[model samples]
Target chain A: MDNHLFLPILMPLIGAALAVVAGQRRMLARTIVLLATLANLGYGTWLLWLVDAEGRQATQSGDWAAPFGITLVADGLSALMLIVAALLMLTTLIYSFATLDGDQERFFYYPLLLALLAGVSGAFITGDLFNLYVWFEVMLVASFGLLTLGGSRGQLEGGLKYVVLNLIGSTSFLIGAGLIYGVAGTLNMAHLGERLTTIQEPSLVTAIAGLFLFAFGAKAAIFPLFFWLPTSYHTPPVAVTAIFSGLMTKVGVYSLYRVFGLIFPNELARFAPLILTLAGLTMVIGVIGAVAQTDIRRILSFHIVSQIGYAIMGLGLASVAGLAAGILFIAHVMIVKTALFFIGGAAERIYGTAELKKMGGLAKREPLLATFWLIGILSLAGIPPLSGFFGKLALLQAGVAQQAWLITGVAAGVSILTLFSMLKIWNEVFWKKAYTDVSQLPRVPAGLMIPGAVLALASVALGLGAAPLADYSALAAGQAFDVSGYVVDVCGVAGCDAAATTVRQENTQ
Target chain B: MTLILSLVVGTLFAGAVYLMLRRSVVKLILGLILLSHGVNLLIFLMGDGLRRGEPAFVDSVTGAVSANAADPLIQALILTAIVISFGLITFIMSLAYRANQAVQSDDLDDMTLTDKL
Candidate 1:
């Protein structure tokens, strides 16, 4: 079963290659991507269960000992991310089947999507820091392609900003990895966990941690670094935007959690003030930005930034409960946010535009679209009996427990504003009278509507079944924080001892 | 050797930043390329300064590689980084070309089609 860890990463790559071979046969390529995504979901679920039952499983490539060879690990956190990623891939691909233009389907879109899936899953499970950087590049390259696929004026303009900023972020990550290697002599994360503690220069370690924070923080679209998101996200096809909205920044957030909690647990306290301050700013600023946006995807794009603030708030809380809440918040937002984009994409189709001023009276014509969209936005705003409420409540509870009053206040204020802004969309798009002639709007196909409804219902199920997921998130947090267990599981006791001895010898020399 | 290389890397970074802040998108891509080269060199310096004609093999008796030997891993890393950056820079160049055509201007300030409120 441990061997199956590579399957998630490999399946998509194989699918991508096959899709490339099936070039020009759009049907064949789509079928390949669909089958691959379905297989991945099955594998991801089985892997999650396997990990839950058997504890963290790690596999070293080439049978080389840990710290010397690249390792792929699947603890609770990775398995959970894997499951969510596969779910998003499948749902969005299904939505794209009906919505995506024929030109996009013919232009290696399927291959790029599979390649992106491969990259994201690779980033999630890789145990080496440099390997993570490599996976990030893979993801970025694919994203750069997807962002500018149609090469329209808006797409080219948006893609330039997205590419440059993300490239800089990836370079920062690479620098961080190189410096960590210089300091610890090993790029393997589990080994770094052991060796880093042995290093005497706390300040250097803090600097490296800060570098990582900036790197991952930029990718995650934290405050002061999120300009690329709102500018670029709405320019893509909604299907492209949906997958990116679900997975991209969250990968950055996940890395922050992994790096801070597992590798830099000692320095987390020192960074907490800065992290919490950024989180609060991110929340307020993101919501304020959302309120000012008139485009459907643009408003939702800004909300992605706002939602990331809550996830980071969990990280800043620096406790197991806080981390668990953050994890749950990410899961909840991924499903709900993608659902909203799907519904919004459908709405965009009806009016032939994404501008809210051009769209109105959608409720009367497509009641089902209005219903799914309402579920999406209501959950986004943290209303009761929805996923967002539970996610926000858990975060609030964690904050109150930690006595982080200022950030807690900021979070609460942001939630109200989130509701206000989402309601703004509701008022403009549904309740308001038609901005354009509603008589001539085309029917929104079931293909576009069904995927979103599935995810919206999933959000409801997530809320009603919050207890089990919370428990699982708590479990994942426990595994992430258990650095020694991680090290021992990856590197045998003797291997860890050898690494420790080398550190001692180097220090003395 | 370390000081000289560090200075070179610093210069590359400085030049890159200056170019990146310019109005021309082509200069920005050039800046990005320079920035990547600087980082690659920085990693090389981090791997430990130059060790001419040294082998990376471990001594059988000590079961450890000689400290004086060059780190082979750093070379592999730098190679990977170079290749990745090369691909990215190529893409960014094409993207700039497309954007330039679409907007009919090389000035970064003019490409505000997507940034409007």
Candidate 2:
């Protein structure tokens, strides 16, 4: 039964290796990637069903017993994330196959993409802290390749800064993991969570938590550490950028949710005010950055940072309702952001540029494309009956319950700024008269249109189905808060005993 | 011993930061190298200091744990870090070289803003 959990991570890894061996055969590589992603999506759905039917909180990987070897545990939160990731990956793979040239497909694109999926899956499911760091490296290495895959001047320049900053983040994660192992004498996350509960050194715990915050914060594109994202993400091709925009930072948010809610609950609760402050600042700064941007993709990139603030703010409230909101917000953002980027890509194709100032009156030429863009952009701005609205509504209610009035105000203000930016794009690109006579622009191919429509439809479906989704999210958040289920599932008998002894020793010391 | 090690790490970090802030691409590469080394050493130190003993998990130990063994996991982790950082540095160096050849400058700001307009 636990073996089912390994398929999501292993399938992609095996596919990546196969693609590397297949090398220049673009057709074969594309087929293999598509099949693997579909298989992963199937497996994700199956795991969700099993968890739901059995009322299982988490699964231990293999019969090898947990904590001693490695485990892939999928709780409600992880299952939700896994499903979102698989869907986004499947859609993006289809989009890339239709759009990117054969040469790009052959050279490191498919393999790195598969490796990235493995990394995200592994990060979501792993039960060991050290294994989480390893998976992060796996993801980062693939991302490094993807960012520079174009080898253009802009790509190399932006990719360099991206690599440097992320390397620092990687180092910080490793050092923090090492410190936790030193203090707790275990590398298993479940074991560490149990041990952390007994430790009396509040300052040390805070320092360790701070390190995690920096490491994951950089990955999640939170405020001061987020400079690398807008520059680097904008350098990639739109297909690749869409996946990164949709899935990658959310992996960071996932880890933050995992560690803060499970391993360092007391620390997070104590530092709630600080996190709330950061969340507000990140939102305000990000949208303001978006408002200042003239390029369409750069504006979207800044909005990624701002949306992350909503997820983090949900966690900052440190309530079951708040975390549920955070989970729903993450899912909504992933779908909506991917759709917006697809539209941005299509708009770029039609206009011959992504600069909003240079693009006008696209609606006149391609109403279908404009309709997709309108749905995506409106959903992104958190309009009613959209996925974004329920996420923000849940978060705001949670904040109000906690009396975090300042954060609620900032969240509301950021929503308006987000709407303004989306409207700005609409006015410039879809409403005004064409800046150039682009009627001669070739019609968008059916292949590209289909994927864009699928993602846009997904955004709406996610919004309309918010009631059931929110219930699942709430269950996940509840499990995350009461993480003893995770500890028992991962550490089992012997590992828990060892961890208890270590915790007792630390308390005595 | 911890104080001395901390000072060394701090100095390396300061130098790395200074070079990272510089305009030249090569200096930034050098800075990354220094910073990674500093981080590697820090992780190594976190393994409860250096012990005058053999590595853990000897071949002959079956039923008993080695009481005097040095922590081998940190050592393995450091080695992995070293290898990964090495790959990243090589990639960054080649990227810098490519950027220089294409744009005729090692200044990042020049590359960024010029492309924007």
Q: Across residues A209-237, which tens digit of lDDT does each residue of candidate 2 receive?
A: 99999999999999888888988888888
Question: Model 1 - which docking category?
Answer: medium
* Reference-based lDDT, each prediction: 0.91, 0.84
Clashing pairs in 1: none
| Tens-place lDDT digits, model 1, residues A1-509 | 26778999999999999999999988899899999999999999998998889899999887766677789999999999999999999998999898888899888898999999999999999999999999999999999999999999999999999999999999989888988888887889998998888898889999999999999999999998998999999998999999999999999999999999878999888999899999999998899898788998999999999999999999999999999999989999999999999998898888888888878998998999899989988898889899989989999999999999999999999999998998888888888998677878898899999989999999999999998889999999999888999998888666565855665465345
TM-score of 2: 0.94
For candidate 2, the docking band is: acceptable
Residue B25 CA displacement from its true place in model 2, Å:
2.1
lDDT tens digits, residue span B14-51, model 1: 99999999988988998999999999998998886679
- Give me the runs in candidate 2 sitting further than 4 Å from their true place: A55-64, A493-495, A498-509, B1-7, B58-62, B114-117
Candidate with top lDDT is 1
| Candidate achieving the largest TM-score | 1
